[model samples]
Target: MSRTFDDTRRWVRFGTDLMLRSVGGLDDDAFAASSALPGWSRAHVAAHVAANAEALSNLVHWAATGEPTPMYASPERRAADIEQGRALPSGELTAWLRRSADALEAGMTALGEERWSARVVTAQGRTVPATEIPWLRSREVCVHAVDLATGATLADLPPDFLTALCDDAVAKRATAPGPALTLRAPTAVWELPGDGEPAVVTGELHDIAAYLTGRPAAPLTVDGAPAPALGAWL
Candidate 1:
């Protein structure tokens, strides 16, 4: 099934809600604990997700007002913001997360059909229309919720979103140099890098998405062999 912007928005809302729930009621010690993401504390992941919401909101503002707003002044500045936010008191960090998400949601709701076509640039330096914003935000919240390590897993994500994520991951790998592999999911098959007698990998849709995105893929098998290391994505 094709996904519409409305579907993207719903997923964003759902994902953010899940993220909030996962991190809720954390104490400073809990926030300081290491997250599933290597070398990143729970606080670091929370801060990054919060800052991401605001950065994306800036893009929505640019779309609605025709101002040339970039997601960040520079890569260094983005890193600095996340680092500073990570040091916030536990309460403040939680507040920032909620506030930024609320602001982004408001910005998205304010955008009309015409504004949806407004051009914007992603932090990765890709130029895309405003319609891409929801997908970007959805990816962030859903995936990072697992990074929080508060018991959320990729399986907790919406099925349709997982399917879309798998497709996107395959498309991204197709453009980069990588070992040729065919991914088999319950509902779809995608050949990564090229179409050939590639190594066949099989797993649940979300597990495949996780593996392709550089997350754990213990459940995935490559041609009945050990899983191959994936190239960098994002």
Candidate 2:
């Protein structure tokens, strides 16, 4: 089933709440521990999630006002902002995360129906309507919740979201020139873009999505062998 804008907005809120709940109890030492993402601490993941809300809110502003507000000033600045956010006190960081997410949602709610069709560019340079903003944020909070290396897992995601995420990840992967592959889940199968004979990967839907997005996933196999290495999703 396709998701309406309202559906995606609800998902943005739901995912953010879940992420907050997952991280609410972390202390300084817990925040300093390594996350599922290599070389990133739970602090880093929290900071990035907070920064992303602010960045994506820029797109909402641009759509509403017909101004050109890029998600970030530049790649270097984005990285630096995350670093700065990472150093914030845990209390301050969580507060920022909550505030930014609320502000983004308010801005989105204030946008007129017509304004939703206004074009904006993602950090990845893809030009899309403002309607995509909610989905973008949804992916960040939901996936990063798991990246926190907390008890949250992909299976905890809504069934619809898992499918959409898998499809989106596979389509994005297909955009670049790379090896061809096939992803098989119990209920669905996706063909990754590239040349040559596709390496067939088989797993549960959520695990396949996790594998595609570079998250820690349950065991999966490629052509009866261990899953091959993959580059970062974004």
Clashes of each: 0, 0
Instruction: State the number of backbone clashes in model 2.
Output: 0
| Model 2: per-residue Cα lDDT over 134-220, one tens digit each | 999999999999889888999899878888898888888888777787889888888887877778889998889888888777645
Candidate 1 residue 218 C-alpha distance from true site, Å: 1.8
lDDT of prediction 2: 0.87
Model 1 per-residue lDDT tens digits across residues 125-212: 8999999999999999999999999999999899889888887887888888778887888888887765445778888888788888
Instruction: Give the local distance difference test score of model 1.
Output: 0.89
Judged by TM-score, which candidate is best?
A: 1
* Alpha-carbon lDDT, every model: 0.89, 0.87
lDDT, candidate 1, at 48: 97
